[model samples]
Target: MRQVESEEFERLLTDFEREAVHLETRDAYGTAVELPHMAKWAAGEPDDLSWLQGWCETLREHGRAGRSVRRARIVSEPLSDYQRWSHSIAHPMVDAGEDIRWVPRRLVSGVGIPGNDFYLFDDRTAVFLHYAGSGLSVGMTATEDPRAIGLCRTAFEAVWGLATPHRDYRPV
Candidate 1:
């Protein structure tokens, strides 16, 4: 196992060759970069979401390069404020070529989820995202072990199968 730096993980966003699949099991998050934006949302202030453009551009690049990016979010229903806000802002990413799907936690009750959210890169590397109880990110640990890779791939696929595409999700 390797401890992955945030920068290195960001690079993998554009470095992977075939596909990148991410599974998010959190209902709320306190990512430093996103907190202020979410605050604006909660305050009824408008945000241009310009901060998201770089990521959107990256997604577009992946599309042009024939690399695919997909994310499955397993969220609690009667959605948390963060997720409700997330649903409202997902259009740009989806439009930029990411396949984002949402599945209610209820739907995944019978599935075995990984201990943390993770990104599986090309089915070879798995980067597990660790977070604090307050929803702040702690760190990410990555592994190339086949068991870990298989676990992420399997879990993500199981949730993906039960998720609704971004456009179709109504976020109850």
Candidate 2:
């Protein structure tokens, strides 16, 4: 296992081959890029979501390459403010080819999940996300350990099986 800086982590997002599966176990986050967007959402301001175009374009390129990108979010019922805003902005990404799903936390009581959120690339590398209490990211750690890979695979598949496709889910 090795500690990965944010820049390397960003590279991993586009460098993977076959697929990228992400599991989000948090209901809230305070990422610098996202905070302002969420604040605008909270204030009922309009957001054209131009900032997301780059990622969406990336997704499109991945799609063209036959690479799959999927994300599963484990959220609480009634949803947090962040998730509410997230749902609103997901359409463009979904439209661009990422398969985004949501699983209500109550449904996963019996499943064993990793303590941190992560992105598993091509089922080989696992980059775990670490965060402060305020939900800002502290750092990221990456590993190619089989045990970590297996656990993440198991947990993500379990949640994915129970999750609702974004278009079909209505928060709470």
Candidate 3:
């Protein structure tokens, strides 16, 4: 049986703890977030995913502020009207300096829904998971690990460069 080294296991646990904090503290606005693999796993479909609710609330909170939380993504499936309605209500709050960021999604990436899973965060972090179904995870954290953050930042920059910004965006 393959066994993890004691030190390595400890480090992994520590990293998980750090990651939890890192993910929670940051203003999490993403294009294709792994909702299924959220920090919490409830029975069946997560009807009341606190993280998702928090995500929405965080965006809305940022929307109230002047700084908009932007997002870029290549859409795969169409969103429901209710989803559109919720976003539409939250998006404007950012523009109005209410406490939300106008997160935008770019449908330019040439990948299908199941094959394409990527997350980018404000040019600071990027994570690409499930490249070959083995599922990979990479991202930066505001922890003491400078090198880790640097690696994630590099990946984010690469994807950001290839992505297109929101259509309504007008550079300030």
Q: lDDT scores for all predictions?
A: 0.95, 0.95, 0.33
lDDT of 1 by residue, 26-67 (tens): 999999999999999999999999999999999999999999
State every prediction's TM-score relative to the real structure.
0.98, 0.98, 0.30
- lDDT by residue (10-129, candidate 3, tens digit) is 343223311211111112233244434332232334334343454565444444443343333322234333223333334332343322222223432432222223333343333333
Off-target runs (Cα >4 Å) in candidate 3 are 1-54, 65-143, 166-172
Candidate 2 Cα lDDT to native: 0.95
Locate the minimum summed-lDDT window of 10 residues in model 2.
1-10
Better of 2 and 3 by lDDT: 2
RMSD of each: 0.6, 0.7, 11.2
Clashes by residue pair, model 2: none
Q: Regarding TM-score, does 2 or 3 come out ahead?
A: 2
TM-score of 2: 0.98
Q: Model 1 reaches what TM-score against the true structure?
A: 0.98
